[model samples]
Target: MRKALTLIGTGLAAALALTACGGSDSTPSADATLDPANPTTITVGATPVPQGRILEFVDENLAKDAGIDLDIKEFTDYQTPNIALSDGSLDANYFQHLAFFDQQVADKGYDFEHGEGIHIEPYAGFSSKHQSVDDIPEGATVAVTNDPGNQPRALKMLEAEGLLAGIEDDSAALTLTDEQNPKGLKFEENQPEILVQLIDDPKVDLAIINGNFILDAGLNTDDAVIVESAENNPYANFLAWKAGDDNPAIAKLEELLHSPDVKKFIEETWPNGDVFPAF
Candidate 1:
């Protein structure tokens, strides 16, 4: 279930090619021309952990000098930020990966443009009942994300661990194949936020969680039995806004996100390899 959201630091508040052309009243309008002398405030929505923290860093260190003021709204659930962005509650958002973003675009017809990749959160599977992947027994219950964009990733990770097989990593509609259940593992799906709690569930033997949720849950990456490799990973999260938005401040913020200082911050903050700079 998507949690009720509140905006941090401020009050809370499209899809498909032809859908882009068919504009909705909820769609954010293109940023109007700004006066060169005044600072512009660009409201962006993001998740609480790294996305919000990274934006806080930019708001403190770089935004002022760049003639921008960032009003960041932190979201706990994945669906709300994009909804906020679509409904003009936020000027932009930075919570979703490319696959998730594409899924949103295709499903909802959001006409949004995104910046280059900023950071990668390596997905991992954690088990409190077992010491290692090999320790997981047959018919063990595993918890994975219910979101279409991320479920396949969890399936792929399980496949890599030899728990399951016959998975198409790129398929959004992917699901467990009973015949391919080499270990006879039972799978359960939950919201990404709920997966962390499932990690502690006595009935759940393994919980595959998104990195940001792991961080938010105060879980350590080193404890994960299996982690996704960051090499050439396409799930890096980036800045996104309504399409045709030519806000100069948005461009500036995107530039700062990929800057050396931001890179250093990400490396030092998450030195444990949970988060990697995707530049």
Candidate 2:
């Protein structure tokens, strides 16, 4: 009886050992098709306005379909996104246009490149107290963006409305001096984001606001007194990354950006044709 009991115990121990060995061996090998070290994690930096919202949509719908994991970082200021991307803290960014990106590269010497063209948010002139551009009296105080990239944009829009004249050479790099204004309109240069606030001030007859800041200020594009024409505007937004990092993730992102899903979203979300899709 003692011998039989000892034999039974030994057999049980052997079976347990086999079970342990099988468990270890059966653990799924890191998907051989996928790079074991390179996970699907990607970090994108964006502004809290439409750019951020667009990325959020991609993270929710597109990333999963592509078998990628997207992490979004929101930035309130314009400069931080490029800085983060340059430092490798972010995989990509989506808040700036080509002109702005070029300016950053030229001024700050950051090595960044653009991915797919996303959308163009047309800048517009809005007035809270006045209903139409015609209502703006002579010598009216008009607020414009003080930034280098957007100041010319504002002036071009103003010139388009016949309030100003001679802007034939308007470009992203063009300044106020490049154009000749005969309307005698008082030009007040301030931050584009603050243009909305200045509208409430009695001195400001009109304010030229960027699309992002316009949305941030809770105003609709259709409500603008005058809007920039998208017909030939070259300052469309883009997805930017470090110069030579063209990885599979960027390719997938570009594909998704140009897909019909994003096109539909841009159409539905920005009805009055304010957001023009580049893809």
Leading candidate by TM-score: 1
lDDT per residue for candidate 1 within 228-265, as digits (tens), equals 88877889999998887767788777888999999999
TM-score of each: 0.87, 0.80
lDDT score, candidate 1: 0.79
lDDT of 2 by residue, 137-227 (tens): 8778888876665576777788888887666433332233424655567888875656778877888888888888777777887888889
Q: After superposition, how far is residue 221 of candidate 2 from its true place, in Å?
A: 1.6
The residue ranges of model 1 lying beyond 4 angstroms of the native Cα positions read 1-37, 170-175
Give all candidates' CA lDDT scores.
0.79, 0.69
Number of the top-ranking candidate, with lDDT as the measure: 1
lDDT of 1 at 212: 93
Weakest 10 consecutive residues of candidate 1 by summed lDDT: 9-18
